[model samples]
Target: MEDTMALQNDLTPVVEMKGITKHFPGVTANNQVTLKLYPGEVLALLGENGAGKSSLMNVLVGLYRQDEGEILVRGTPAEIHSPKDAVQLGLGMVHQNFKLVETMTVAENVVLGLKHLDFIPSFSEICRRINTISRQYNLQVDPRAYIWQLGVGEQQRVEILKLIYRGADILILDEPTAVLTPQESGELSRIIAQMIDEGKSAIFITHKMEEIKRFSQRVQVLRKGETAAVLETSKTTPSELARLMVGREVLFRLEKKICCPGEPVLEVKNLCASNEAGRPSLQDLSFIIRAGEILGIAGVAGNGQRKLTEVITGLDRADSGKVVIQGKDMTNRTPLDLIQSGVSHIPPDRISMGIVGDMSVASNLVMKEYRSEPVVKRGIFNYKEVAKSAKEKIDAYNISTPSQNTEAKFLSGGNIQKIILAREIGACRGLLIASYPSRGLDVGAMEAVRLQLIDQRNIGNAVLLVSEDLEELITVADRIAVIYEGRIMGEVPAEKADIKIIGHMMAGASLKGAAQAAAEAELGEDGI
Candidate 1:
């Protein structure tokens, strides 16, 4: 990057934004933001959640209109009012969430709304073009396969193909690797490199510092709504980037203490469950989450993690198993029964399973206790007590909202996560099942969630922590269990656990096999 400064001065900027401003309902998303992108380089936009990276990119792609700014494309001023306009100008964006018809083929989805093409495209010709571009970009997705049949990583490839097929040379990718596995993330890096080799410029909006160093030449740090600093990716450290993002010194690792195990509070023995398509999800899965310890379940997504959490929380039925909690058989028990049995659950789909969106925050807070004492003296609800508890929990969780009566839907992802964490951890009586507690949160919020889980474990609660983040498992959990397809691959002590060993196990190597091949895995770096 330091050596590339000469080329930056020689080559003209492909895209430039000067003094951009944008405002939302209660906050200014961006204020006087400026940026420049030259051809054949990847510029990493680094920031925390709600730091206006998305807003700036949205404006660039015509998904949002800046309050005031001048956008120049190839040294000429341009007005982009819609996605169609942006596409015609060689600008394209691959969002975090894919916009694809689940039942449609990849080829069909690619040629869906191409107004510049023939009125009707030949299916064979479309497939041929998809194959060619996919090979050229290192994005290998089956053109004939339906979107629903593909995994998250494959689906993202289709999104990238969509942009390339539309004749876009300037790409904007919003958290492209967030939903991908470690292996898939490696593939994505290769693809981006190919794009750069072909003289195409890319703007990667991400919070991952390692990715910034590996992929990008320059890094742009945004805090609140203004430019904090611009640094060469190779020169800056992760700690400095984190400080720029949070405006304070940050903790890189979790400080977890030893946990003294007591009797088992949750036992899932000989469990079996089916997916929505009647396929085996969990097969003979048996595990014990003891009191005063965190058992982290690590795996790639869709590898029976959801079923394990649901079956334990009594949200989904198990074909055959015993869910014994605190010396009581609670298999096939109703969700309310499990709740009453002192089992608190923080589900993966927080908005759908954790809280009611349209309901008041205060009402949602008291949902677990509305039928119990203090909050419910008679058959009617107690608004006063509920509000008191909600206010206290909101403050304790550092939830920023106008009031307790605000709708839950209005909160950001981090705030929503905090609300659920506060409720579940505050009321945990025996066992707490937390699944993907920090899925989409920023670093600060993620640190807070992990600390809260450790706090609960310290207070004598059996916690089953499920997450896709390997570093997080190495941080807070006392024991890490690898889950491959359905069954547990193996368990390892979290103290000094090697990530390469866990990665090998995640890729379906046996515990003993992984240990034997640990040195080999390090050299080859396979199964990561």
Candidate 2:
């Protein structure tokens, strides 16, 4: 303990949550949680997936009402029934997913719900205020630019600015750096330090042990909907924290041998695709992924990430491109055709592309294999056979659910990801195109997903991994390539790469010089 109570001598505790408890129909999300946030300190809420970190914060932020609890703001019990009330009480939250209007300008989003007598937001005044705030907090964001144009990191800065502009003293950030590059994460760290200097308190909810060590003064570990341990960040190592969080030691990386890539398994050449609005998504994109290797694509969201997946898997038609799958031309084929030809794809939007929310687990499990025998015969589905198959997959994949009839929406984020993994990875043969496979998964689920991907690579299957999570790329990817503005900037062996170099490339920096310089260095065995 860091004597957090003693640290609040003259300064009042900004937020005090005592005896908080919440329960879903079949799950206890939080149990008797007690937490106090001081005037100017960062408290990192540490937990694995399904660990109740988000549940506790959701209660505080008014997304979910606590079954039993008292929230005291500035030593007074405050009634916060909604997000609006939380904002009125000087409490703000930036969610794991950024909530911003794509068409709106930065200043507009910052002042979104506030009352303005005039229809206009006073452009010059808002700009001046935004500029001053940016300078004061080291939260640099262009106030005039459209939200959709900025990177994921920049968009999050705008979210933070929204809270600050609303006069928030107690800020809650959920998984703030889950998608950021190392450089951007470092910049965010500086910004948080500045917020504390200005006498603001922060609650950082994250699973990253490294971030807890770097930022928080005190760490609170939540396990299975309860506070398992609370300790000083300086007094705890990542290993100790991991042990407490998971109840055992968890191997952070998958050990594997390095092997030369076999013949090209999946090749894309001059791929041009369209966005949702019918404009160009991918423009002259070209890349090649080899068997027995993981080719990681690093890019900001909407740098043709979904479109790239669509074009390769035949969900969307390419204006022009050549997609070769195991010596067969798969360009412009139907999605079913691609799947039948042994291309297992874990699409980006899990709800739309991966699983059907209202559908039963068994129904979804055999969705892709409806045409195959035992699942389909004479246009009739074998429900008994499908249920058996689903049960087997669920047990093998460790999906935590009651039965095969359990709705996909009833499961947690990690379990949903598990279903996708079990379906796609289990069906794969020649290629696996996984996009953001571990987006909302807990650390243990993330590790399992990575191991499965590696297992596929070991079995001589090519994997195209597109994700914004840099750590996942570094951890599991054999070769990393930067995709900027719908083109491959450069490729590097993961073992020889650094975050600095890769991040710069991700931000659209040219890699011509570095690629030329590293031509000779790219040789030799460097297992990623």
- The prediction achieving the highest lDDT against the true structure is 1
lDDT of 2 by residue, 1-528 (tens): 234345455666788899999988668888998888877889998877667877788899898999998999999999988888888888899886577999999998988877633455588899989999998888889999999888777998999889888889899989888767556778888888888888889999876777888888888888887888888788889888888887888787678779568999998988887766778778888888899999999887767787888889988898887999998999999988899899999987675467898988777777777888788878898888898889888888878665788788766656777899899998898899999888767677777789989889989999999987777888888999888877777888877777666766777766765554445345533533
Backbone clash pairs for candidate 1 read none
- Number of clashing pairs, model 2? 0
Candidate 1, 1-528: lDDT as tens digits: 123366587777999988999887667878999888988889998877667887899899898899999899998998998888899899989975567888999998888767665566689998998999987877888999999898778999999999889889999998888767777888989888887898899999776778899889998988888999888888889999989888888898877777899999998899999988899999899889899989999998889998998888888999998899999999999999999999999988676578888997787777888778788887877778898999999988777566788798766555676788888888899999998887656677678888999998999999999988888888989999999999899999999688988888898999989887898756677656
Give lDDT per model, in order. 0.85, 0.83
Where does candidate 2 clash, by residue pair?
none
Q: Distance (Å) between predicted and true CA of 288, model 2?
A: 3.4
